[model samples]
Target chain A: MKLLTYFFQWLMSLLWVVALQAQAQPTQPYSYPPSEVVRIHSKILNEERKVYVHCPKVDSADGNKRFPVVYVLDGDNHFELLAQYIDYLSRPDVLAIPKIIVIGISNTKRTRDLTPTNSLLNYEGKPDSSSYQGSGGNEHFLQFMATELMPMIDKNYKTAPYKIFAGHSFGGLSSLNCLLTHPDLFDAYIAVSPSLWWDKEYLLKMTDEKLKHGSALNKMLFFSDGNEGGRNSFFHKSLVKLEATLAKKKLKRLDYRYKHYPTETHMTEPVVAYFDALRFIFKDWEKQR
Target chain B: MKLLTYFFQWLMSLLWVVALQAQAQPTQPYSYPPSEVVRIHSKILNEERKVYVHCPKVDSADGNKRFPVVYVLDGDNHFELLAQYIDYLSRPDVLAIPKIIVIGISNTKRTRDLTPTNSLLNYEGKPDSSSYQGSGGNEHFLQFMATELMPMIDKNYKTAPYKIFAGHSFGGLSSLNCLLTHPDLFDAYIAVSPSLWWDKEYLLKMTDEKLKHGSALNKMLFFSDGNEGGRNSFFHKSLVKLEATLAKKKLKRLDYRYKHYPTETHMTEPVVAYFDALRFIFKDWEKQR
Candidate 1:
């Protein structure tokens, strides 16, 4: 009986040592592709703006090459996501998209800067006191991008003329607003599940009013909707209406594609939507030719 | 004319100064989710191996929580990709998948470690003098994972028993090989565009021989193919054959899914395949349940 107790005590001591060793092993952080946070003082917004920038590695053969820039909103959520996608898709083996700079615009006042019109109405068109109180400062946000942010980026990075504006949800609503108001700001636009229900479809109305039928607007556009509420939800209906409106315009030189993802939720749709949107925008990017 | 020349020279001097200022801006690296590289000596493989590990942040409420692990092949290509996906999917709002540790197994010898057979033939059933030499070390590789690497991970990290094995191309072939030879090793498996034409459909034939008809083999399998050659390419046909072979067996309790991406290339397919595979694997996970 005494020997048995001694064996048990020895086992406990070994266990304690093993456990301590496990905790003591040294670990170092893994390296990721180099990206940077660029804090720019925006006069239009009257505050300092922080943007995450991811530039592709300089090609040894052509060190002076310039790259296209993709300025994505809701940077805190989707900047790293886009940066990862661009890095993988633009690899020499993949070449699905070209090497480009990704500029993620982190938000300070999210609802204020993303919404186009001031209203307390939520997704259901019901007044929500807490959510949309300080909304509708998108015009100033665009000005900040155009005059302050864009000039700062152009003045610094090896950037090409081709630019893409991408966003999700309220950010998506602002993307459409930018397309309608400042059409030439970006060569392409991506709106992933834009909240067309905002202000009783404010951007939808503006898109129809601003775009002329049979007019040439040489740009690429990719928009998508996820199963937000259901098949008969306003989200689906709004996207269908947007597609119909675009089709009815018959605008020359406008290359556009609309995709509906029924299996994905609003939160999960960005994973696939951004990828498909990249494919649609770069459909003409034939590698090695 | 003299005044115009003097003005042009002054403008040139100002532009040079501005360019120099642009070049002088120092940007710091953006912070990503902390991941680590762990090196272990593998007795089975007779070499040292390095694996990248990404763990979820410890919840303040439950600091001692353990996580499911996903051991993915081709660490050089897909380690960061899976890490990013897991981080995004397991966010507070998204919560599509449970917080899990991602272990990316980096390759020392691509062909030797991933291939199941020693044949020196290429994808086209032709002998390639440049590639596929000194192959057929997958069994040893699995032994390494089972004995050395897995024990190291489980000993050092807070790990649960629910493991997943994910791979692409040759790595995918090895994934299937593991599923066949050691079905109990992983709870789930993801084979993205598996090279089924390896060694004259050896694994395909092995799958038919090994899995009993109408037997209970509870596992989640996700396999896919891209537009490698064409509609009737060997890559497509081989995947079709594997799907058919699995269906023919009528394997009971085997939750399997097959996807074909006609628009995606072999190299670009993993971008979407990995995302889709994760969704399929975690389809039943309800948020806030």
Candidate 2:
């Protein structure tokens, strides 16, 4: 019985080796392309943050090419999606968008970094202390991005000058805050259903006050909202006000578009909204090509 | 000199052990949850296939719940994109789509398996033997999917009855072919920019012949064409003909919609088309919920 057990164990080990060999051999059906997860320490945020970077297939043709970077907020939620989009849209045959690097900044404290002002007001104009704790860190977050994260990414990867900042909901508010305060940080901005009701529409007031009439801003902005409370809701009203504010400014070289998706929800809007935002920002890119 | 060499070797082995230990330990800066690459052998196609599966964050709330499967063709091109989309759209809060299993079938002789008929005709009605060499294996490919791939998937993964068949270009042609021939294979079919010019508009004829007037087919079909050519092109004509044929049939239970994206190219269409297709197919689903 002891001899039989030893023989069976040996046969099992042999089968394991055979299976490993089979896995190593390249078959037409099975190809495991390597995708790595990178982690870096951020001094400004005082926390070691992780960013998911999905680079394009680097063949001989694209050896020395530099890619534009897309820094997406809510990294854990939308990083993979944006990475996949960049990979597919930048294929040689499908050159709608350029090959781009995606830097997804995952969150530790959601309310601490993405909000502009640390207020306890909820969407309904009521005080919600628990939800709004540690808010108003948008400026600090942007500083961390510009000073710490961006520098680290630039030092590590092949990147271009053109950058895009994207976010949704609270992240959406962060995107707009960056656009308003640090317009030079990104070439384009995408805010899907931004929490404009934050601190009683603070961002809207800032947008109205920031731009001088007929100023040459030279930036691209894409913002949209979904059916938060049907067509005639306060969420839609705030979006309308923002659009009106932008229209009133008539800033030169400031390319902007506002889209309304009545059929999509606040959460579901990001998927279509982000795609449209890309399309809107790059509407003239294909024409130039 | 012999003692120094032994010390150097010992130091190297210690460093290797530390590196391996670092990789195994999930630390704060290195919290990379490794994704799995699953491979299954197909008996009918006589080929082994690989699938990249990223399941949701498995917590105590959802322990043994099964997921719906989304089988996308042209896996090499669009698997990661669909995987990311599925991940984002099926989040706990998002819940636009259900938690689903994604089976991306990578191409093996794409022209052979995606084209409908054995013909050497190009888009302009001219004979293009070089391009059409290994055409007309779609039926056999579908058989491989049904008899081999589907069973293997069912046996291995936790799958629900609901399945989606998606494809682009020639793969789109295969998707439509599967819909007409084997309607029971998938609940929803998405054909983005299908090669309608294949074998003298073979699938168009098949659509006209197979679907009876006022018949209850009980299927959902979403087909669209981007700007393959300008407005007065054969690609657009074929899509128009398909719509007309479907309209003439007047199938009571068949829910279908044809979308024309004049702004998008053959390559750029899928990004937006797929999103629109999903929304259209599930437009009423949300209301029901």
Point out where model 1 deviates above 4 Å.
Answer: A1-26, B1-26
Candidate 2 Cα misplacement greater than 4 A, ranges: A1-43, B1-59
Candidate 2 chain B least-lDDT 10 residues = B26-35
* DockQ score for model 2: 0.33
In the range B9-83, model 2's lDDT, one tens digit per residue, is 888999999999988754323233223556667676677766655445556777788877878888877776676
Residues A1-289, candidate 1, lDDT per residue (tens digit)? 5655675688899999988987786565689988998898887889988999999977796578999999999999899889899998888888889998999999999999999999999888998989888999999999999999998999999999999999999988888889899999999999999999999998888889999999999999999998898889988999999999999999998899999999888998998999999988897884434
Q: What overall lDDT, based on C-alpha atoms, would model 2 receive against the true structure?
A: 0.83
lDDT of 1 by residue, B156-247 (tens): 88999999999999999999999999999999999999999999999998999999999989999999999999889999999999899999
